[model samples]
Target: MAWSYRKRIKLIPGVHLNLSKSGISTSIGVRGASITVGKSGTFLNTSLPVLGLHNRQRLSGPEPPSDPTSSPSDRILPLNQSRGNIFSSDVQEITSQNMQGVKEVLLLAHQQRKELNSDLLKTKASLGGSKVKLVISYLLIYGLIKRSIPEQIKSDIESQKEAIAQLQQAVEDSYVAFEIDFDQELKERYQKLVDSFIQLTGCAKIWDVTGAHHQDRKTTRSSASRLVEKREVRFSLKSLPEVKLGFDALCFQNANGADLYIYPSFVIMYSSKTNFAVIGLDELSLSQSYVRFVERDAIPRDTKIIDKTWAKVNKNGSPDKRFKGNHQIPVVRYGELILNTTTGLNEQYQLSNYEFTEAFGNAFRDYQAAIRGTKQR
Candidate 1:
């Protein structure tokens, strides 16, 4: 079952603090209509109290029109766009799950972060105390106090604010990155793989094929169906092709299409869509195979031409003589790389280059094993 949380608390006249699972926002206006600003975006909300009707509309950052061609179908045209949440900005919102994992892998400057947070908390507490004292001193001015408490508190707050600013800059600069490293031979192989990835100038198809069954059918209405179907499995409520990959940190797309980045302690299944996930090298599984792709369009530079087949083919590999103006289409051999984990991380990518993709997959596994051996010692 799915669940959600939302609440509205009135802070003052015509002011409300709105809270929801997404984030916090404030609304300004009467019960009938108001403008709200939140982490997702700004919105205009209106309601009819007597009629028990309400309407909400986003008032900022209009979403881009959906691309009609992006939908999955039986058509031969491969999907051309990144298969995830459509955001106007390049930055992806980090989902709540696996956030701790992200913090552990990235944010290598832990000590600096700790110190900065401590100092900022102390300074803010002091500032808050000073403000309270200033308020009390003004109320009791005629009774006993002679020194200017307001001026003293003002000076203290200013100095503390300056100190807080300096600490923030130091925090930003003191951290060191824990980047992935490769040996000389592995590094060369990795670079070659990266080159192949960059050179994939054509659309890549990601296929998920389950078990196949043999079906026998007759032309009569009482006979069984002729077309057999295979189920496309969904992982975390997303298709296999929708998974993303990244190099900086191990990243995975959540059910809501948000990203969760983790430390790269194992295998990195990078997607061409700039999303990635990290799994332990030992637990990760990889498989590489050549796909005999029937190219209806221009062949990619990285793929190799295997053979030719007619657009209208018979039961065999030959062209059907009954069809007129039948043309031949090149059969290209493309590389398919499949990555899987016991935890349901299954991603498949069809790369244009077969040799390099296979080489990288094999070498990467060997490199992971070597690293595991060193760590065990």
Candidate 2:
């Protein structure tokens, strides 16, 4: 059996959303000339049917020129279309199938990253000899060798320009412009949510539920068994930096994978795997709870130690004296926050402070309601 998919949706004037088996991309321009950016890369397309002239070139070598009038659409490139890293797959929708591929890529890359990095460096070294002289001359002329402005600073400035140009081109090619105003109440609520999020400490993401078991017993039976669940959680290696959320936009670095950027209308989910998706704020939901976690490693300062448990516990919850290495462990209470949407956006985060997490969730919910009310009016 053979299957194929192709679609070209006109999002706005001179902007088209192209869907293909390869992945989703955006084309900006008119019939005679246009530029398309996608997972594959940027391509310039030009055609003159009357003159029978046509040309297509991939803009991979050099940074393309920018349009002064265009704005930046940082979240325009949907999932699997990012060129940052290996998560370059065509994510049509936020489905399990689409995300599974990304997870596989992440796992595979993690396993072979060392080998891949070594091989890549060796190959680059072998091929970089000819470019070394040019690099040195460029550095010298740029005052990097003189230790003046600093090469890093210069590179950063250039990079910022390139990034803006790319983002602006994407916006010009795909999005339409609109504006919304936030009332004083809405602003206050939004600020409260932001403050709560900033106060959160030491978060981890529950990536997968590895195993689950359920057992039921009749009332006649003295012994009863309950459901048991096991989850696979991923923690960030380093602490997140302090980032302020404004009325316009805010970005929260997820403990494990994606960075969640909240906007007035929607949220942008971006993963290190180079995948991104935009979701409406109305479609998103938040739930909060508390968990008594066994601490085998260093306990976070913000987490509350509500109880104690044995490393080797018996059926009755007592220490198993038979185990020579049995030790008492603190049972820390962690605040759990789960964000869900009908469109397969499910994420679980556990933080040290439950109060802050709960406050954020409540504030967000209230703010969402306020936005809905305003739109209706």
Top candidate (lDDT): 2
Instruction: Highest TM-score: give the candidate number.
Output: 2
In order of appearance, the predictions have TM-scores of 0.43, 0.45
Candidate 2 has its poorest 10 consecutive residues by lDDT at 1-10
Evaluate all candidate structures by whole-model CA lDDT and list the values in order.
Answer: 0.41, 0.44
lDDT of 1 by residue, 293-320 (tens): 6667667666689888776666545677
Candidate 2's residue-wise lDDT over 80-141, tens digit each?
A: 22231112123225533222322332233333333334433543443354245436656678
RMSD of each: 19.7, 17.8
For model 1, the local distance difference test gives 0.41
